[model samples]
Target: MADNIYVVGHKSPDTDSVTSAITYANLKNQLGMKDVVPAAAGEINNETKYVLEYFKIAPPVVLNDATDKKVILVDHNEVGQAVDNIMKADILEIIDHHKIGDIQTGKPIFFHNEPVGATGTIIASMYELNGVAISKEMAGLMMAAILSDTVLFKSPTCTDKDKATVEKLSKICGEDPQKFGMEMLKAKSDIKSKTAKDILFGDFKKFDFSGVKAGVGQIEVMDLADLAPKREEILAEMRKALESEKLDMIVLMLTDVIKEASDLLFVGTAAAKEGFEKAFGGKVTNNSIYKEKVLSRKKQVIPPLESAFKK
Candidate 1:
């Protein structure tokens, strides 16, 4: 077991993060890497839970710390978003679909980063590139990740490659992508049992933009009505979190998958507020703003905020 290597994804694990770790680990095993185990940085969210149940697979172990372990990262590369104490681990490989981040290593490792809709899309392709067969379970998980990340191919981040990969996985999994994707999305939309903090931090991520720290989270639902009444309650938690986390800003995106839009609720310092305003040309009313066609936090939200804050 000394050769055991854990495959893990970013904190506040979403479907893409959780499923990508699992599928990538499976790929590693099929390629004769026997000791590769999949792990999650936090509790699996509801949407991911549904996928695991549908696939009849157990969720990955929640591993917060990786000190003295051999690990491969998926879904994210930023140290701030990674598992705790990741810097202490012996980094072996990274398979991600996000921007290259500040994770430095003692030695060069296999780093694969693509600008695809989901990490699972890249991993699914890896299975083909390696001539390894993806099992039905693995294909289902990959399909779920792609659908979740791409918002059923409605997100601006979705590409031709992502669509093609989903088509391939759909056939392998023997599930209709449209029908199955709605079921998974409906699972994600069910947040009645979650507290305001739970809803806020479910998919949260932390970032540092030129020394200014900010936290951004997103929750995609079929309708915004379910969250309308809790808007004030959620904002209260965001305000508290902004203070407690010592963040310059906190932004939560309430995305309506059906509407293909997002409503942003934010709490921030003066500088952060200025940057936020500059990032998106809109008037902030009552700590919230409606943004049409803003479905992707990574491609649409973070880039402008990063650029706005850098100056």
Candidate 2:
């Protein structure tokens, strides 16, 4: 059960999702926004783990409530993850740097779901807007998240706004963005002690789209070479994940930062296949994307489905 006002990130969280939730929850509590708690639906990847360890922070509490009420959702706007518990509370506010989804919030509420590089960037802006002092730890988390999500600003998903926000936050954090980028990606890449199941479902969720069921997961890596190498492992695990969650369809987004295009992995039901095909005119071959682009569930994946589902 969540506290008075819980703070949760999106399913399959990235550095921005996890770190921003923690930092934002910390700030809200400091400002007397009582009963604030930071939680994540996914496990911390190696890169995010390093950032937390560097700041001596722990992972946010694990939460998988698909119907969250009166909570703040960071990094993602998919209805499945955000709505679990939405009726119980009210979805009071949303602060994200992702493309908007079917957000269910009370009227006259504050929502900041931008197409920026990182939720941390949006959080940074909030601190600046509210004249809240940015702690060094919070600044560091935001800086790292910005670098990771933007591919050091080489990502097609990045906008000039993302750079400006990161630059300002970096100055506050005293981190060299370029240096940190290399280090962070390297940390995320060398995954030696993890199982394929742990690796895949470590940060996973089941999405019930009214009647159509779908699942989405986020994977961040510095190199694309490992993707083909890990292809078989990913496929088998995704099949298991679909069965375990009992989802009608599951889409595994193998987003390679280096390659850009996400290798979209599809499993189960014809409806999802047709739904995704109508959204993106990409040829499907055992759930793989030929042209690799920066695959962001927030920016690319969820938006199309939102439009398609309405039809």
Candidate 3:
């Protein structure tokens, strides 16, 4: 039994993934679990970087592979979303909010999967349950995760518990949720600084359905116009990704969080294109489709796409 345990999140680490690992690792250390170290499986995105800098919290060390380490996973469970060598590691526990996938453990572990918008929501309750006081900085980090994942409480994945947890976290951090959320989101909208490949892989995930491979990437912005200039560049990169990864489809969702709409750009097989049409009932014009009231990628995008692929 190794004394050290690594707390890490899924690959293509989002704010919720990074922050939940940090917060949970802190909770574990406070509860007398020594040598609990927080780690990230991928580079932190712009939004997560902004949150860490604002709170003056150091970013977690990047763990490229799990190897023989004892680990706890946060924000995601699928092996595809996990770090390289994750299947070979000793998975001690998992705390996630998404649907479970093909992760098999050697033995029973502490698994907490919930239907909330963010993994941070579940971790916040854990802090209260274990009587661990959340520091102001931790609360702020958790607040950022909640707002980012829920898209300022506008996404369909948001629950009453998510809202209430964010309210308490806001007060703890001495900030207004709407104001802080807007600032955080605006930080991510500076896509002009990143290359097309960077933008495409920033928050990307790969899924497999009956041997059909789909890669979906999402970028949340205040306005879709910001992406218009780089549309061609992004599409080229997506095509390159589809071919390199041998994916049946590659979809990039340009989500306008304020408007609660998504303009999707895709390059894929005819079956994949047909799946999109059947899923949203919107025509893909010039390689894109504008879908209103589409925010959560987990709920609105993946599920519908999966269902359509099955047909």
Candidate 4:
């Protein structure tokens, strides 16, 4: 293993990805590992930016590619979501909460895959396991990541461990979980200033299953009705994305945090529509489907779509 390592998260980085990478890197350094620097596979999202600025921590260096570098991945294991040139890098470790994708390595590596809501929760337990004290800033960042990934503990992906970790972390950070979580979510609610491309790709992920090239993007808002006016514009942009990316299917999930529901917009082949209808059991009118209690894309969206594709 190389002495100098880069800790990174997946593309279109979210709060959990950013914080988990930094926190894990810090933990490694505290345990006598050196030069385990944190990096981001893509641009940080608004919520992550808010958390980093609130804690007065600088964002990680942007790493577009990892050719011939030693790296540790957090928050994602999918090759499509990974840093460019990941196949050429020496992957030493992986700590992630999402589904494992088609990632391969030439040598054996340390892997920690958990079912927790956020990668930060797993990293928090690692701090205890390693006997490293969590600093106030680290606590705050981890808290932000947990709250963001779990949607204030409202998403179906949230586990008891996530809630417990956030309660303890909120105390260390000296912030009320509910109040601070709302503030953090509000920071990402404003989308008027973002371009169509930005809105679509802000939290996008691509998946390949059984020869199906699918992309799913999500944006959380306080109110789904607030986005009604821009529906056509957004769908048009999604269509353009599908064509440009050469995807078999593309889905954009407009999530209402308060309502705990998601309105899905899709554009793709006829088989894609059939697959969605079979999996979701609803008519996709005007290229959209309003699904109640559909929040976690990993749990609710991808699994069903994968099942549908197999048929």
Candidate 5:
């Protein structure tokens, strides 16, 4: 385990990523572990920004690069998937729900990654086990995060703990899941001036996935139709990104914030296509579009791929 733990989350961070980092940072600090910093790879989305503002909490620190500190990658561990602004960490431990990106440690890393719905739930459990007092605001943030990521425990990635946490946190936060979900979606819906390319890869990640190179980028907004027109533009940008970066594959997730379905775009060689087909069990086309069962990467994409990689 690394002495300095820099807790971070996936790119284009949602509430779960942001809240979990804050809570985890607090825990590590309370445990007398110095140098625990909460960080994010992308700008806070409108809904997440609202959550932070409502709780009177400042946003999590933006991590320009994950390699900047001794990494304790949270919510995501893809070396390429996190902020390119990275500083080398002496010790690295990862606790994420997303597919494990290529993680390289001179020594072994403490990895606790699952396909659970929300990283917030995972971190919440850790806090409960440690018996830390989570403030109402923190609880709200954490709960909101879990709810958003798992679509209020509807996403396939959701677990009993996620549901339980949201239920418990809802009481304290004074938020009804149904009501809050509506409000949250509204917040994310008002997208202005964002191009399809901008929306798609704004919080892009790149990594060395074992021997294979890969990248993951996401666009989470209210309606898929808004992004459809710019589909060609998005694909072009992602295609260039993969080619120039020399990645084996690049996965673009166009998630419908409303329907909870995503069209996965896998761009790369035959090996990358075969990897996705074998892992996700869907037909891969000549181009990159593959319909996926779930929209959220934390719940759907990461878990299956993890299971596949281990096999």
Candidate 6:
């Protein structure tokens, strides 16, 4: 195996996932691991692009397959959400902030898992713990990741640690967290030229709900008005994905960050409909549900759906 280690995050790369990979790899390199590098599992989204541009940091190279490579995972632990062909790779370490999913290694490795909001929060703290002074660029990236994942501290998943990390990072980067965060969100929300498919899969994930295969995507915007016109078009794309992917259910969460709510759009089999109802008690109208205060998919959406499908 190559001695070079690629630090990467989950597919459908969010700001937290992408930034954590870069920040963590920098930390590893600073600690004398010269071969450590950062990589992204998929295309960088607009919000992340804004962050990278603001910090004058380049995006990591995209790594589609991890076969025969050494890797340290960030942001996510689930095999289904990992880079392609990851099972054939040599796992080194995992740093995540979500409930652990199935990703096993032949040997024990450095696995850091916390319930904090963003993986960046953990990576930022690791800089302090390792006695490395965070650079301005790294601080900006970390702050953006925390703000993106926490929806500027409005998400239910946002922890005190995440808030503290962002507060510290903001000072180091000399950017007001709220002001920069809103600008970043505006970048994400501007989907004027994006295809319906692009908007749907820009931040999507796949899951096994019991025996059912489900796909869920989320797009966070400052105003839901931006999506109001394209709702039908997006729903049509969702239906297409449902059949083309052979998924039992496909869901899209059009989240409004300012309002802290989501409009859940889905297309699925009858069984999937039943499970959806079981997950969130509401009548699905026009194949959509308006959920107030539903922001974090990792925290709010997936858990109940997983349980609902199992029953």
For each candidate, how many residue pairs have backbone atoms clashing (under 3 Å)?
Answer: 0, 17, 0, 0, 16, 0
lDDT of 5 by residue, 7-72 (tens): 777676767777888878877887788789787767877778877887788887777754546766
Model 5 misplaced regions, further than 4 Å: 1-5, 31-35, 65-71, 83-87, 99-111, 207-212, 269-292, 298-311
What is the C-alpha lDDT profile of model 4 across 123-202, one tens digit per residue?
Answer: 99999998899999999999999999999999999999999999989889999989999999998878777777878898
lDDT value, residue 15 of candidate 5: 75
Best-to-worst order by TM-score is 1, 6, 4, 3, 2, 5
TM-score of 3: 0.97
Instruction: In model 1, state the lDDT of residue 44.
Output: 94
**Which 10-residue span in candidate 4 carries the lowest summed lDDT?**
1-10
Q: Which wins on TM-score, candidate 2 or candidate 4? A: 4
Give the better candidate number (1 or 4) by TM-score.
1
How much does candidate 6 score in TM-score? 0.98
Q: Judged by TM-score relative to the true structure, which candidate is superior, 3 or 5? A: 3
Collision count of model 3:
0
Q: Give the better candidate number (3 or 6) by lDDT.
A: 6
> Which sections of candidate 4 miss by over 4 Å?
1-3
Candidate 3 C-alpha error for residue 76, in Å: 0.3
Task: Give the better candidate number (1 or 4) by lDDT.
Answer: 1
What are the Cα lDDT values of the candidates? 0.92, 0.73, 0.91, 0.91, 0.71, 0.92
Summarize candidate 1's per-residue lDDT along 110-217 as a digit string, tens digits: 999999899989999899999999899999999999999999999988999999999999999999999999999999999888889989999999999989999999
| Worst window of 10 by summed lDDT in candidate 2 | 80-89
- Kindly provide the TM-score of model 1 when superposed on the true structure, using C-alpha atoms: 0.98
Q: Per-residue alpha-carbon lDDT of model 2 for 37-126, expressed as tens digits?
A: 888765667788989988778788776664544477777666765535545556767887655566665577878777778887788888
User: Which ranges of candidate 1 are over 4 A from the true structure?
Assistant: 1-3
What's model 1's lDDT at 9? 94
Q: Which stretches of candidate 6 lie over 4 Å from their true place?
A: none
What lDDT score goes with residue 55 in model 4?
Answer: 94
lDDT for each residue of candidate 3 in 1-311, tens digit (9 for 90 to 100): 35578899988899999999999999999999979989999889999999999999999998997989899999988988899999999999999999878899979999999999999999999999999999999999899999999999999999999999999999999989999999999888888798999889999998986567989899988888888889999999999999998999988999998788999888999988888788888888999888999898899888888788783
